[model samples]
Target: MIPVELWPIASSLKGELLQMQRPQERFAFIIDCFKTYLSWE
Candidate 1:
């Protein structure tokens, strides 16, 4: 399970990505987020 503190960051990341026009950047952002979460874990 994810930690509570990460929820806001995740939501904000999603929101930011949603407003973006570049699909590649959005995908990379998501991959980076996953990498970050893995590192945190």
Candidate 2:
């Protein structure tokens, strides 16, 4: 289960992914976002 604090970030990522046209770009974005988020914690 996702922690409550992460809900905003997850929602924003979903929004960005929906706006993206290419599958590769979406995949890369997810990877990059997770990397950044993990680094913060």
Candidate 3:
């Protein structure tokens, strides 16, 4: 699931650009990877 904090930004999107199915899975996967990288501090 997408983070609640990201809901506002995601919800602001409109039209077919935001209509791609299952994009959230990709977005969340990316975020998880990014978090892993950042947490290496």
TM-scores of the candidates in the order shown: 0.70, 0.75, 0.45
- Residue-level lDDT tens digits of model 3 in 1-41: 76798677556643433555688865775577579758965
lDDT to native, each model: 0.84, 0.91, 0.63
Q: Give me candidate 1's TM-score against the actual structure.
A: 0.70
Question: Highest TM-score, which number?
Answer: 2
Tens digit per residue, CA lDDT, model 1, 1-41: 65798789778887999998899988888898789878976
Residue ranges of candidate 1 with Cα displaced over 4 Å: 1-3
Candidate 3 yields a Cα-based lDDT of: 0.63
Candidate 3: misplaced stretches above 4 Å? 1-21
Report the Cα lDDT for candidate 2. Answer: 0.91
Error of 3 at 23 (Å): 0.4
Q: Write the per-residue lDDT of candidate 2 for residues 1-41, one digit (tens) a residue.
A: 77999899789889989999999999999899889979988
Name the candidate, 2 or 3, with the larger TM-score value: 2
Pairs of residues clashing in candidate 2: none
Global CA lDDT computed for model 1? 0.84
Give the winner by lDDT. Answer: 2
